[model samples]
Target chain A: MTTVIRELGDEQRELVLNMGPHHPSTHGVLRFVLHTDGEVMRKAVPEIGYLHRGLEKIAESTTYPGYVPYTDRVNYLEAMFANEAFSKAIESLSDIEVPERAQYLRAIAGELNRIASHNITIGCITMDLGAITPFVHLLRERETINDLIEALCGQRVTHHYVRIGGVAYDADDNWLKQVEKFLNHFEAIIEELDNLIVYNEILVKRMADVAVITADDAVGFGLVGPNLRASGVDWDLRRDMPYGIYPKLDFDVPIGAGEKGTVGDCFDRFVVRVRELKQSCRIIRQCINNIPDGDIIGNVSRKIKPPKGEVYSCVEGARGELGVYVVSDGTEKPYRVKWRSGSFSAMSIIEHISEGLMIADLVAVIATLDVIAPETDR
Target chain B: MTSEALIDYVKGLLGDKTKWADPEAGDNFLTVASEDWKNICQTLATDKKCSLTYLRNFTGTDYPEDDEIELTAHTFSYSEKHGLIIKTRISREAAVCDTLSKIWPAAIWYEREIFDLLGVSFNNHPDLRRILMPEDWVGHPLRKDYKQQETYRGIPTTRPA
Candidate 1:
């Protein structure tokens, strides 16, 4: 009466494994079809659009003011930057004027947002690179910035602090002082981070020359932000194409050291963001003192449409160059609204860049790209 | 360095071939044939003044009633300090265009999106797969001809097309 049970064969051979769209690590709703040859990745085809809500198409249907909330969720990582770009779009379209004070305040918050975003990227990079402790350490510091954002905008992550013409409100003196103090303390902490990871022999060996993307290929891939610059594209929307009070602000736009990939590698990307944190601190300090006094948001054109014309508004977002292309037909709602997202370019290159890499290295590559999946899908 | 000045100079480069470069207010745009978008993009990208390396976006708006698909390519020139929004329309029957991915690598995803939602095919895109839609999804959602009472996922949407 004994039954013989046979073990199923094909235990350790080549097989296709699906990771996400919801598996804790793909971040948010990202599906990666991983073809692995025993832990070594044969192919990593990231199937996105699982979360595409047709945001651009939706924008054309909604009124100008109504689309602000939608913009807040476009990237989700850099909501403040998204809000800024969206507001800039409306402002440019209708010629809604923003005053000097509002511009300075926008810069201040924009700089703070830059720091927050960089911290996330840094923490996430180390976290992916087998250093989980640094991720928590980075987030611990980032929480303070989040608290400040919450106090300023009444929400933590998706702080809809920006409006059409300018910011929704202004920061008090106490908040500005706190921001300044945070900036100074952040520099010392970042140095400690450098000591921890930047010069560490293990981290460098793991990261250096891992995923190399040439500058030419980077351009072909339409990469932007730190990812693009890391590959030797001397282009930054903030510095090269100035908007808000960024033109007046004095800070060095940090170029990638290029010690990693050809021009765009993971290590240089880390270097760029780390350097940007310091630059953002400098920009914020200057903004704190130079901030003027006036109305925050102006009267945006609410009821009617702009004209039977089109406008493209671009701004240097935390991730990359975020643009909103609007086609109006002299109505309440836009005839067409397309978001030229920076992440769009970066994400598109995954096919070209992610081919034939290891699983652990693939995750590292994903972090270096610094693309929020929602932004890519949306 | 202004858009108008840049357009004026570009017109000079074309030497009377530059037709339909309409300058409306601050925006100066040109409408070329869908087939010519890639070559034009290459010229814009490589030309000394119009170093429009950044393919700002590639999107299309559908008008089923008009039986046309208006495709737009927004390019920016860092050297000239101006942006040029190029627009062209193709017959609804043939919603096809040359892929600008070669001239501008950024256009790959954009072309995929245009292919995914708008149902516009890029002739030679390296990986012209669906971007914001699933691999086995039914129809392009952004197409004016396509009617969607609700999305494929049936995610309770109150907004109408």
Candidate 2:
């Protein structure tokens, strides 16, 4: 089976390598077709749809409330954002007002989910860069957040906590106290993890100055979330678009500062997520301190039939802007539902940036971009 | 700027090439003529005042009842901090519409996704291929009247229903 073949024409000599619908570093059932010239890649075209579950088509058949659980599968890593985006779209169309307490609860759950998602993102990137210890440490910290989330909502990964009009369940005072306790302990854990990987010379050398996305290119390509911010673009839907309780809460939006290398490089992307972790902690702290006491759910009917209209709602997911566009024809089920995900836009930019990059560096680009398969394929 | 002002600003720039639709039941959107789809988008991206540089979202919905597929391009201006929805309806049979990928690179994959799912082909698209569905799939899955193939490469798509 191992036979040597003679080389032919130059065009034919360029090897086409398949980088897995199963590759560990490729991250979640995604395949990349790499056109390589020896060790250097000419371009890496992403071949997706392995995880496509016809989710949008399914939305047409399911009722508004029934669709909440399905949105969880859209981006399992940041399921809270998917849930919130869909719920917000429905709520906006139906004119259902959530109680102040539910808004605070939703924000609290969202920020905590953001932290957990970023933990996995940073951990996976470091792990892909050959730093396993940091990934292990971050995973340990993530479990504590998961435990706190479990205390609030039963499930760990897909909380399904953010429902249309409001969150499914309310957090008890004890659970809120545990969240505060976790945040205090997790602040030191972030510092410890930073020491383990962020500033490490080896990881910096691997990521810094690689795949620098210009601010213009970032905006033009529709890159969202940290990936867009990593390119030094000061556009965050949470602040700029302002939804739910975000207008009342105070938190800083972190952008790429080029501490290790040029702005918008892989290093900047990594650093931005780390900075965002601190901001998420701050937002969660405020939500806990200023949370109002009231009804957890809104005055939504058991059977929600929104008026005939089309609305677009977005939330800042861990990856980027997770938006849900819904067209309701005065029915319980949506007429049309389209998801605009951060990873979907992030995936589109790869073929543009992967040119002339070392084959090994592609992993870093994929990691920093944080393009999850479920989000992209959904 | 507010959404109303932004719509008016865009209308003033485009002149007679587009029509502003004030749907009695739903939200308002700028509907561009089929021939002027690409021209209007190019202007929106390049015009100094209407710098909708970012193509936030592009989607195609099949409206079989109307015998047309509505393509909506949601554009946002990073500099101006405003956004407007541009929509155009093309005949479902023809399904050919101007591509926005040349103006906004983000639309490249989005157009492909629409083409693959809803069967709306974008003219002059760089690489128009099946994105979410298989290349040899029988029909556009998102179409309201789409029929599921009995089998894909000998693998049954549905349990004996």
Candidate 3:
């Protein structure tokens, strides 16, 4: 923690600085109003909603199946998780049964998306900390994941692949072979990222002991995913509340051990994401090896109207627990839809923790949180 | 604890304050009066039997037919491994309720968002302002009767037919 400096008279007047809405490091259209006394920040107020698209309002008008494409736009980086969460909500409401092979396919797509998202998180964090080489290297590896996803689904970024009953399409033998080939070399790529950036002394010194969040504060502020795990709270929605084929697969949830500094600092958050990349790879390998042979889509009605009921379903997204709450009116269109995004809660805690930190370190904290603006403001 | 036991425990605590409890719903839905919203939330967050510390999601639903706006909050307890959906209905004319930002800081943003899009107000909120829309926006867009403006500062606001 940085010490607050106080001086008398006109020389010590507090300065107000606006940090984004167009700044490159913000990753999107996010603005922070900082009230600083010299180098130490007195208060940092986050002004979000610049990228708000009224996705919830849009969901009310679109039918259950028609809204699947819009779900991809909610979180562009990890669209599969968003797609799965929305689809699962519909499935629970209508009591639709998904095929076993489709569950495995969805898990494989989700893990691949998780790896791609983590690559961006690590790359952006390192690049923000003044290391440019690792970011390019990580993105180069991400290209391979993108290629694999493109082979399965037509689109690369927003793959609206998860349908209500199952996935949009089945992966052919060629697609499965390409996934196996990518997994064979993925472990070494994670190790290369570890050596190139994670172990670098400058990166550790810059991130360690910065923006520490205790376990109590993490829960009180509703922090989820890596941010909450980094605070040393052993909670992951995928492990605790098993969904789809995640219960069948075996993997470990990494928690912050405070190796570089105290628990829940920037370093632990960065390291947790790095470790998760390996876990995602392990899940992917298991899913690909044991994928069953059956029909991809289940027997669902063409009308796509759910009974008059409300359901809330969540999946462990790239950022955290992405939940979808849908209220149906026994009609073609939904009555109400609310998206509980992980980034929204992650961004809410920044105002409390940003006080008493240097302005430059604020960027590091934001990067480590890995909040996508569209998800937060959606 | 199971969701049924959790709801029973909350029912015992709230007594008359608990308007309705449906454990069979997707997420155990519990409705309470708007007056007891703050205290009930405080008890839910702090009580050992039902310590729902995690505020997962919060939003408002508009029901013009009922002439009320329903504010719903989804809370989960990591220690207990249970969840409950708490809701309160207030008349649209006076859509004000007590703020839970003190109990869970995450509610501040949700309350602001509801206030922004649905026109719900939270009393004693530290910063109760529009979140998703600009401060000077004309109407709450999520309401059933909300109409789009033709223009904003001389620029066409609607899509061309």
lDDT of 2 by residue, A1-378 (tens): 112233557746677788988898988998888888788988899999999999999998999999999999998888888999999998888889999999999899999899999999999999999989888888888899888888888999888898888988988899999999999999988787777778999999999999999998999899998999999999898899898899998889999988888999999999999999999999999999999888998988899999887988889989888988899999889999999999999999999999999999999999999989988999
| Model 1, docking class | medium
Question: In candidate 2, which residue ranges exceed 4 Å CA deviation?
Answer: A1-12, B24-26
User: How well is each residue in B21-55 modelled by candidate 1, as lDDT tens digits?
Assistant: 44343355788776666777788789888887767
Tens digits of per-residue lDDT, candidate 3, A49-146, equal 99999898898788889999999999889999999999999898888999999999999999999999999999999999898888898898889999
Q: List each candidate's DockQ score.
A: 0.53, 0.71, 0.66
User: Considering only N, C-alpha and C atoms within 3 Å, which residue pairs clash in candidate 1?
Assistant: A21-A30, A220-B105, A230-A263, A230-A264, A231-A263, A231-A264
**Clashing pairs in model 3, backbone N/Cα/C closer than 3 A:** none
lDDT of 1: 0.77
Q: What tens-digit string does per-residue lDDT give for candidate 1 at A1-378?
A: 122223336664556777776764566778777766767776777777877888877876788788888888887768888888877776776778898888888788777777888888888888777788888888888888888888788877887888888888788999998887887888898899988887677777767887788877776666777777788778888888888888888988777766654446678877888888888888888889888778887876557467667777777777878877777777888777788777667767776776677787877778878868788777
Worst 10 residues of 1 chain A by lDDT: A1-10
Interface RMSD of each: 2.1, 1.5, 1.9
Model 3 C-alpha lDDT per residue in residues B1-161, reported as the tens digit of each score: 88778778888888877866453335558898888889989999999988899899898999999999989899999988999889999999889999999999989999999999999989999999998888878999999899877887778987899
- Candidate 3 residue runs with Cα over 4 Å from true position: A1-12, B21-25
**On lDDT, who's better, 1 or 3?**
3
Between 1 and 3, whose TM-score is larger?
3
lDDT of 2 by residue, B7-43 (tens): 7787787778778776644467889878888988899
lDDT of 3 at A157: 96
TM-score of chain B of each: 0.84, 0.93, 0.94
